[model samples]
Target: MEPGVPDDSENLSDSDIRLETVIQQARLAAGIDGQNYRRRFGSTLETDFGSALLRCEEEGLLEAIPGGAGWRPTSRGFRLNNRIGLLLLEHRSSGPDMDRSNAHGMAES
Candidate 1:
């Protein structure tokens, strides 16, 4: 495995990767589609970010940062974020202990 890279990365759902990226980006700035993310990951990643953001928003897990074109986790989002982080860690460390299905049915880099 590539150090720090999830061992079962190939098996990770696009939603998982997208949400992770958004969370990481939010830490750096406070948004889902920051310039750096767009530059490094390309526009294709934006679609994933959009869908992920919408899903979280719908789930009451994320909300816009007042007047900014950014998002922040709601209290509910924060609680679920920890659960997600742990699930991801479990997948990474255990290496395919559970089956993960991609609803999109298409693999994205």
Candidate 2:
């Protein structure tokens, strides 16, 4: 519910369905390429990304679309993502300023 975070919009429309398809393709490619990369470079990751996603699904954080296009985040997943966003925002705000640029003449004033 934060300014930039999307809420529990789980009901998938036509556009959402298309997005799901794209997500599925991207995940598939990442899984394949990621496994190959691990084997070639000896990644320390024990479980694969795909398996992690499957575990998430099993935990009710996501559910596969009816036509198998891809998965959509459940309400719990939405809450988790929102909380993560909030944490990231808080962390950034609490950290030392990374941008060295002092624009708008405020640093001089």
Candidate 3:
């Protein structure tokens, strides 16, 4: 894999996937309320998933409104999530073990 890239076998849990889905949905919907997202995802908004979304915002993947408000995905965030989806798909296709070395061409460089 690329030096820092996570292996496909390192799959996100259902909760994580749900969080990502919520983020994407929020993006599609323009913005999303934290409470509403929490409800939809069947988890508290203060858990690791919520924290991850905040981290995404800090990393420029999304933008959070002020006053503890809602969030919107940035162009970069949208693109990243798309890429993540593809990677996940590839991982699934490769089976649970997921040959990351081949998938990432780590042997080439």
Q: Score each candidate by Cα lDDT.
A: 0.49, 0.38, 0.51
TM-score, one value per model: 0.43, 0.31, 0.44
User: Which pairs clash (backbone N, Cα, C closer than 3 Å) in model 2?
Assistant: none
Best by TM-score: 3
* TM-score (C-alpha) between model 3 and the true structure: 0.44
lDDT of 3 by residue, 1-109 (tens): 6988767666788756754665456546375565565566654333423444445556676666554445666788676766434443443344443222221121211
The lDDT of model 2 is: 0.38
Tens digits of per-residue lDDT for model 1, 41-83: 5533324444445456667766665423356667776667754
Q: Against the hidden true structure, what lDDT does model 1 obtain?
A: 0.49
| lDDT: the better of candidates 2 and 3 | 3
How many residue pairs clash in all the candidates, one count each?
0, 0, 0
What is the alpha-carbon lDDT of model 3 when measured against the actual structure? Answer: 0.51
> Could you give candidate 2's per-residue lDDT for residues 3-100 as a string of tens digits?
97887667865433432433343333222232333344343112212333344556665555443223456677565644323332343345433331
Report the poorest 10 consecutive residues by lDDT, candidate 1.
98-107
Residue 77 miss distance in model 1 (angstroms): 0.8
Candidate 2 deviant stretches above 4 angstroms:
1-48, 82-109
